[model samples]
Target: MTGAPRIALITGATQGLGLALAEGLAQRLAPDDTVYLTGRDLDRVNHAVESLPGGGARVRGELLDVADPHAAGRLAGRLAARHGGVDVVFGNAVMRVGPDDDPREIVTEYAEVNNFGTTRLLRAFAPLLRDGGRLVVVASSLGTLHYLAPILHDRFDGATSLDEVDAQVAAWRDAVADGSARGGPWPGFVNIPSKIGQVAAVRAFARERRGHDLAHGVLVAAVCPGMMNTPTSAEWWDVRGAPGPAEAAVPLLDLALGPVDPLHYGRLVRNGKVLPWSPYRDDSA
Candidate 1:
């Protein structure tokens, strides 16, 4: 609380987990710290900010549609001019499709937001990270290697650049379009690969920052907050008794604002632990 004021940004923060994250940060950060809660809708964004504790004094609302292709960069540029640099960023915007959704449609929609938008956010905000800043991509356990076919394991695990990860995503889209992806190799749940691409992007980005000269060095990771009983989750699965967004925000806030761990860098983390990249590992625990 005695350190310099911090600047944090949370995408898709109008509601659900993103909103909860914004609220948690607003409450935990120093009084002077600024937390930007962003969403595609200007009205909702404003409403979300106005609803936070402290009369939303430290929280600001911004319009951000991750799918816009240029929105992230624009926001980052404006933030850079005002704050010089950012301390933490949560790439929390995403799109989810249900089981009954068309495979081709799912690929198109998820790629725009969940997959490509993730890469866009990283590319724009990463350079603005302060010395010890953290960039967290809100991925899921379904993104783990174990959920993907063995054929794709090496491709995702060995990817060292965003372009490489993108190639895999493009391939999946093509497979879905041609009707060859209907069976085993890829999971029936199309969203799995989108999340995989997200985690892969995090690992790839982390590797790129290996030798940078920063105070504590920047930490980037893909985090799975687990299932929450939010409207988004309720849309796909029966999360009747699942934890709420506020409960799920605890670990995410810890990972973002707590001490930085080099081991957690560039890895998939959940509940404060790093998830294995190997598909064969028993990750159920």
Candidate 2:
């Protein structure tokens, strides 16, 4: 509404927070604007597109599996060809690992989808951002630096490039395979490191982009939409009375379509406020 006809993309948008994000964007965008809702399942993607408010005129669904190393790149190519550039991108696809899940499988899956998936999106789509575009990576509160041991803080915070972040993730994956990750500074919960790597990738990408010569400059933020009563949440914990995805999507919609602030750039944000790297108390609650 505030800008020209925009093009937006939301990955893993067939259900939960991703679907809510797609709906919000579709409602707020101009009638001529296009909102792409991507998921791995074609039927689910079609269902999500049909479920939107406007009879699927401007909303288009595409199959996307972020875990596939080449999928994001291919999607980016198609979108770039069609729209020239994108106005907004929400890296919302994620994977959750349960306690009963195999540690080795968790390591491989989380590394592919959660950690490097963020990297893949950044690499593929960041360059295609139109002037005054926005890129929001939907991370988690567990991604805060304080969630891990103090000794591990520098690895994320000191990362000034995406390659550095990738190196850290690779190192962690190797440690997990070699059985040395148990007593290391890493958190016992595998999801924490994966989310941290996501936030780190966004930060590193933003920092690297600062030196580039793009007009109006793109805005990038890693967002923690907080806990919600989604299917994904139900897989890991009890969400008896938690807010639904639509309610949780309010702030994310604001971050995506609302005004941008330079101060919030490259920072982990929640409810329109910047989340501290290390707070005195648990800020997640």
* Residue 15 alpha-carbon offset, candidate 1, angstroms: 0.9
Listed in order, each prediction's TM-score against the native is 0.92, 0.92
Candidate 2 Cα outliers beyond 4 Å, as residue runs: 1-4, 55-57, 211-217, 279-285
Candidates in order: C-alpha RMSD to true structure: 2.5, 2.9
Candidate 2 C-alpha lDDT tens digits along 57-128: 289999999989899999999999997889999999887677688766668777888888889999999888
Q: Residue-wise lDDT of candidate 1 within 1-285, one digit each (tens)? A: 125679999998988899999999888887789999999999999999888878332998999999898999999999999988899899999876765788876677678888888999999999988877889999998888888889879878889999898888888877886778886487777778888889999888878885682345678889999989976688888999999999999999999888877778888899999888676764223
Candidate 1 positional error at 10, Å? 0.4
Model 2 per-residue lDDT at 107: 88
Q: Which residue window of length 10 is worst by lDDT in model 2?
A: 276-285
